[model samples]
Target: MYFTDRGIEELTARRGDESVTLEWVSDQLRTFVDLHPEFETPVERLASWLARLDDDELDDE
Candidate 1:
């Protein structure tokens, strides 16, 4: 399994039952990036991808 899957699993186990809004998630990502600048690019990409996830083109990726 991919190493990142462990973190994903942990998140699921920890907070999967909670309800969250997109704004909450966006704020969290921004806070994370503020604390961990090195991950800004990846976080930005994820945020952008999520923002445009409904677009037909990204489905192909």
Candidate 2:
């Protein structure tokens, strides 16, 4: 498994039962980037990919 999987697993284990809105997630990402500026590029890519999750073009990646 990828190293990131550990964090993903932790998140799932901690909040799997909770329901969250896209707005809430966006706000959280923004807050995270504010506190961790070095992650700006990766966070931007994640937000963009999330915004286009339903698009077929990104499937090529």
Candidate 3:
């Protein structure tokens, strides 16, 4: 999911209050997959990383 700036802002707003919806998570994961086409590791690793909230979790962050 290639998020437009609006999409990203919407997601950030939803996540900020710790009220994350499944849709937001799904969108973010899809965005990651779209951004990193050369990912060699398992998708599970990616999923695991996506499930986390740590500051150092995502490379783009």
Candidate 3 lands at a TM-score of 0.37
What is the per-residue lDDT of model 2 for residues 5-61, given as tens digits with 9 covering 90 to 100? 999999999999999999999999999999999999999999998899999997888
Error of 1 at 50 (Å): 1.0
Top-lDDT candidate index: 2
- TM-score for each model: 0.90, 0.92, 0.37
Q: Model 3: per-residue lDDT, tens digit, 1-61? A: 5657787789688866787677877787677777885663555575777577575646566
- Candidate 1 lDDT trough over 10 residues, lowest sum: 44-53
| Whole-model lDDT per candidate | 0.94, 0.97, 0.69
Sorted on TM-score, highest at the top, how do the candidates line up? 2, 1, 3
lDDT of 1 by residue, 5-57 (tens): 99999999999999999989988998999999999999999888888989999
For every model shown, the clashing-pair count is 0, 0, 1
Ten-residue region with minimum lDDT total, candidate 3: 37-46
Clashes of 1: 0
Error (Å) of candidate 3 at residue 45 is 7.8
As for candidate 3, its clashing pairs are: 1-30
Sorted on lDDT, best first, the list reads 2, 1, 3
